[model samples]
Target: MRRITLTEVGDRAGVSRSTASLVLRGSSKISKETARRVREAMDELGYVYDRSAANLRHARSMTLGLVMNDLRNPFLADLAVVFERSVRRAGYTVFIGYSGDDLGDQQQMLSAMVEHRIDGCLLMPAAGTERESLKVLGSHEIPSVLFARHLGGAEPYIGPDNVEAGRLLGRHLRTIGVKEAVFLGGPSPSSARAERLAGLREGFDGRVELVDGGLTDSTVSSDSGSKAVSRLLGDGTIPDCIVAYNDIIAVGVTYELRLRGFEPGSDVAVASFDDIWIASQQVPPLTSVSTHAEEVGLACAEELLAQIDEPRQNGQKLIAPSLQVRASTGSWRPRKEDR
Candidate 1:
């Protein structure tokens, strides 16, 4: 079947191709009557403009690229939804990619976006990306913004303050009268994980004992959290409270504790970051630091759009986390001794 083009629409409307282009691009220069006629002609002829070629000619793709560590994580999924809507509202489309925490994959995705000539990008970097990979994006003149996790060398980021998330969890545990807490998460290279740990330390003020229960990587999957629990038990480092990297990890910790004949709220309190939907549905609802995934997405979209309008802007933006108390953190009546 022959594809209908803008030229055909112009011919049908008794206008030139440039006028049709102006109408399609929503240029204010086109009169309302003319725009209506052009639009009617477009609908009648089934004209579909070659947006790709037009975008190339204008040096503006009207598209944004979004990269994340894993799309399976509920937090990232929610973030993606909000970001897509935000971009669409701003008259732009979005392209998303999952790097699976692989540096090579990150580089490949970046290269692909460049090939597609994306106007800007929002990246949730893989755990292992170095300064050099970030520099490549800058060199390409792509206005890239980091989301969820910050790559040290990236231009600007719109994400939760990891350190604050950790501190919130730590303080909650302490207020519940837990003197010892286990920190369960992935690798140290993960900026989110590292910042959360540091925040926890600040909250505890070196008064609480911390047991590092490391997992395979930064992915907050239930299985990884469960494995970390097993490792903690094997090392005889069980504590009065458990602070997980995120809600997924907290869920795993809760499940494993029940499997081992320990009640989550009574035997060991649990807290986590990212108030994902499941946090409230767990056996004992999870107490967690809320990173507001949707807000992060909106912020990233806004930042990218701003960069598109003003290319020389520089600096980073940090979003703080909110704390939510639940049954998982022993939110019931505190014991007499605890007071």
Candidate 2:
């Protein structure tokens, strides 16, 4: 039979895992009636509270768990490989798990990692993850470090400094005399995109007007980029520059521009984030921000390992990003011909 998870108990009791945990520990914070509900739920589920076994869970397991939503993402794919080397050199093994960015899958992954008693966990949380969802880790006193995305609460997080990336692009645009820009972004309600835009505004210093491309829900790809740019052009909302969410999106934007007979480099400067492998291979080559994928992996491994040694972890480390300027954003000039 499978072990009864705290998440299941919490679900049955209509309380959070933290609340259920407090009931197990006899914490005074829980009301008598609430505690009764949790206790009864535990009894119904046949939970075994082996305190000694729980303590031994924190002992060296010589293994770590890594969870991510997507392995296809180049940066994350690179991170997986680099992070393994970083930890393996430190005399540890890593177990990689994919959550498909789904909340249910994430819950299961975390539970499995806990059951295995991995020494620590490195997480790139699924989209729409709440701090409450991470209560499972807390309930087990597991050392977990988040990367690439932040989920509020006091968890250690590591990711590229997106705001600085935006600043780099913005400053570059200013040098080229760009008075207006349309930012093509993916995935709505994203902290990274918001931070980048805020930095861009600061970099522009009120000199350049910013337009929202309004295509955040679609997957980041050449096709989405082409569609976003096509819609912008159809609305007669041409700008001096196009800022894409990533290299793939930028490629699409450039393709759509060429289809409309507008030269990407000469007529409209383009830039993107994530100086991926293909960024330099583009027709005019892309201008992008290098998040330094290997460095991010190393930094993330450092944090999770430290947290495993001591559970009280410092929160949030932002790795600096650098801009790689190329032909794409070099020589944009207003077209002489009218539409």
Candidate 3:
């Protein structure tokens, strides 16, 4: 048997299709008797209301897309919570997608969000996702705010000042008389990573030497940190300090160091970025740079909502960084010869 049609139910109810539709939508304008008649007809015809189909007629879906590269990182997890809460309070639901730092997956998620007719999006683009690849959203006229990893261009972006975050770590390490250090984790060829490296270079500025232990993996993760430390141990060239791309990687770095008979703060020093909630909960606690994920997420959501309202391409937000000192990194005295 074919599916029951709303028009047939209207005919059975002795009412016009529009009036029946109003009754089905629970419009106060419809009389109780008319609504009851429509309901009876619907029950008789076994018709089911398709709310999504009804929503397609509206000017807005009251929905937003939230796409991220990774969820394992607590920073992103916290960001998602903040963004979702803010949007929800404004009467919007969120469609969450994780691309796992893959361009293909990101594209698929964007396409689906477009198909669903979401009003806007907040994206942390996957690694290697060029600006052109995200043109799908623009072509569909879906306003978006890029958070964390940006793909560049004049589109709206809300993220941390990575260079400043790096500077915070670098300056602290230098002040503590660190002579040699290693920067670990983070995906390569990334704007955020590059900025941090530049800031570190400036902060060190001939005061501290660095061991070139950049990305051992394509993306930032605890596994990458563990592998980088493992290789460094095999080389028997331990730096005075290790700076992680984020707290997730710091967990691995600190754990591996201790497992290999080296203390985190006493034997060597460890510092990281993204002052996640767990950063201060670690065994030694974590010395980190605060990206303020909550504020960033809220800003990004507000920016997108504004874009959806007025459609601006130049919207941008850059959050400042602050340092969180912890036992993981200890201040050392400068040696007489070095001083």
Candidate 4:
């Protein structure tokens, strides 16, 4: 049987198809009585309006697109959950796409979002994405907000205070007498990595010898951390403490250290960012800075809504980071070097 069309409902209610469409979409311009008549006609005729088609007529998809650099990262995953919940609560649907730190993939995802006609976008851009692509988003006037990471010279963003997070980690290590420290980081251009390095340097203040773990693309993975540890061991430059980019890398560092007969907290301290669930479940647990993933996600959603409601508002928003000290940093004991 052919599906009942909107024309049938309009004819039954003595209204035009356009009027019926407007009523079904709950346009405020339509009278309540007309809307009720249209709805009743639809119910009586078993006519189901195509919502997607109706949204297209309004130049809206009633959907938001979320792009992430790494979906496997727990922090990003947690943020995705928050975004999904918040968008759904606002009567919008969410579509997620992962770019995997690949510029080509990022571009492709952006193209897909534009083609799908998403109302707005939330992006965690891949390191080194071309500025032109971000500019295109602005040209289209599609409301967008970067989350967890920001694209320089782009629109507003919401993320943790990475520099502060780095400083906090550096200070904690310094307090524990970590004179030689290694920072296991991902890509160089990543806003998070740059801010964190700056903060760490500020906190250390040349008191500790800093080693670069050679992560140059925001690709925080166990394999990268393991390889970094191997390189450090080979170079005979083991630091008193290691600060990993995220929980995944931290776990990898801990595993490699243990395999090499080194105890994580005692032989060399370990700290990381994100404070992911696995951080606390590690053999000795990990001391980390909490980036508040859920809050960041919610903030991104709210910012997108604000932009849609009022496009003139502009500027970035920063979320503060909090430190969680755990067993991985050796019980936070104070040494008697001063005494």
Global local distance difference test of model 4: 0.81
Could you give me the TM-score of model 2 versus the true structure? 0.80
Please state the error at residue 331 of candidate 2 in Å: 1.8
TM-score of each: 0.79, 0.80, 0.80, 0.79
Better of 2 and 3 by lDDT: 3
1-339, model 4: which lDDT tens digit per residue? Answer: 788988789899998765676676577667799999999998898887677775554476788889997788889899899889998999899888988888889888888887787888888988876567775565455778887777766467899999999999888888778887788867667888888888999888888777766763346788888878877777787577888988889888898898888888887888999898988899898999999999998898899887664443254788999999998896543335522
In order, what lDDT does every prediction score? 0.81, 0.83, 0.85, 0.81
Q: Write the per-residue lDDT of candidate 1 for residues 98-214, one digit (tens) a residue.
A: 898888989999999888888888888888777678755665567788877776653577889888888887877776677788888754577888889989998888877887777
Name the regions of candidate 4 deviating beyond 4 angstroms: 1-58, 216-218, 331-339
Task: State which candidate has the highest lDDT.
Answer: 3
Per-residue error (Å), model 1, residue 282: 0.8
lDDT by residue for model 2 (215-247), tens = 834465688899999998998987889999878
Using TM-score as the measure, name the better of candidate 2 and candidate 4: 2
Scanning candidate 4 in windows of ten residues, the lowest lDDT window is 330-339
lDDT of 3 by residue, 1-339 (tens): 787877798899998675687777677667799999999999988999888876664479899999998877789988899999998999999999999888899999999999999989998888787888777886666788898977767768999999888888899999898898898888876778878887887888878987668777786778788889998888997788998888989989988998899888877788989998888998788999999999898998889888776565578889999999998886434446656
The Cα error of candidate 2 at residue 324, in Å, is 1.2
Better of 3 and 4 by lDDT: 3
Off by over 4 Å in 3: 1-58, 331-339
Worst 10-residue lDDT window, candidate 1: 330-339
